[model samples]
Target: MPELDSSSMTNPGSKRSNNEDCFLSLPAQDLWMVADGMGGHDAGEVASAIVRDTLAKYPDLPLSESIQRAHQAILDAAANGIGAEGMGSTIVALKHHGENFEIAWVGDSRAYQFTPELGLQALTTDHSYVQMLLESGAINSIDAESHPDKNIITQCLGSQEMETVRVDSLTRPWQPEQWLLLCSDGLTDELSHAEISAILQRYRTPDQATRELVKAALNAGGRDNITVQVIAAPSQPKPSMRAALAHWVPIFTHSRRLDAIIYTLALLVLFALLYWTIF
Candidate 1:
């Protein structure tokens, strides 16, 4: 299995006095998650904490099932008066299995994939009123960004109206040197996709990328709790000497670069002579 490198950060932001955001990083289990809570007082904090703690306890569970369990747990807490009546949270969870990974999410806490080839790609869609408007052609991407209802999510965990949460999920083949980012809306609200892509491209390491992302968001006016988790696949290993020779032989033979062709021919001739002498 390819090795994984990961980093995570959470902050209350410039306007918020308390953070209602939470994240979980279990590299041993190849699982990571971020939750953004909603409600008044400390209820939002309780809602998001329940999501993080529950998923942390059951790291091996399927992403959707675990989130469902979290939904019930949150509802149970509210019923028992653990939090306010309308407390809830948005969640995005990712898990890796060998060369493949699965991601599941609810509400607007987003999952994104970044690669050198593709830059930054959103892995999960937002479950929000603004997203609906954009999809229906009632609003454009620019309008959605500044929409007054942009923060109004359509569904989330711990909603009194939803007995069974609707979890959106997808599985994809993992690639070397790729990054998976899970973050709350606070980060997205502050930074545009272009800004985020530039930051990721600038910082190759997961730790530096997460730190710079949070900093940029704060600089852009952090109006809500911000949380981010960045996971990177191991860099592809360099080819062995024999493998290098095998790869170059074909390319060099077809190349117009005289020095490269001569170098490859000399290496081949040396190997052939050595083989005959040994035999």
Candidate 2:
């Protein structure tokens, strides 16, 4: 199996801990996640950390299952009343499947697939007002920067009942030197795709790429919390066995529904099969 190398960084910006942003990289499973929180006081940080902590607990799930369970975990955390009401966060998660990968996201945090041929293309669209305006042709991409409602996000985890998040999965036979980039609004707001691509090309290591990306945003006047994670697949084997194993470890002792509806459903299906055989 190919091993992934990753690096991440987060900064609070001018505000205190209220606006929390964080990233996690599971090298063994080649999974990476970035979360950006929004809420008054320190609630945002609390919410973001809670989501990350919940996901970090399970590192070894099959990529698709892992992504779904991560979202469910975040929703469960919100429902359990960990923080003040109205607290929510945006997330972008990427998992490697052999030479392929899958992604899941909510709110404005984003994922980017980078290759020398295709350059850098954003994989996730922000659930923000300005994006809607841009899509509607009421405004252009450049105009979105100064739009009055630029910061308004329409969807986020823990904000309402039965929230819908965007989940997308893409896979390609692993290439010699492919990279995956995930980050929050902080980097995109201050830098363009070309700028980001240029920096990535220059930085040899994922750690340096993350650091320089944050430093560039900070130099441009970091007005918000910044979080970034980059994972690059190396052709040779690497040390990610522990993380891969952790991800596969079941987070729950047993499926609560198994003893309830699941068992009943199994019996019903079995009965139908026996009836078909007899009849």
**RMSD from true fold, candidate 1:** 6.0
What TM-score goes with each of the models?
0.88, 0.75
Among these predictions, the greatest lDDT belongs to 1
Cα deviation of 74, candidate 2, in Å: 5.1
* Local lDDT at 162 for model 2: 49
The RMSD of every model to the true structure, in order and in angstroms, is 6.0, 17.8
Q: Return the lDDT, model 1, position 97.
A: 84
**How far in Å is the alpha carbon of 19 misplaced in model 2?**
4.7
Clashes of each: 0, 4
Among the numbered candidates, top TM-score falls to 1
User: Model 1 over residues 96-208: C-alpha lDDT tens digits?
Assistant: 88878999999999999998888999999999999999999999999998999999999999999999999999999988779999999999999999999999999979999
- Which ten residues in a row are the worst by lDDT in model 1? 247-256
RMSD of 2: 17.8
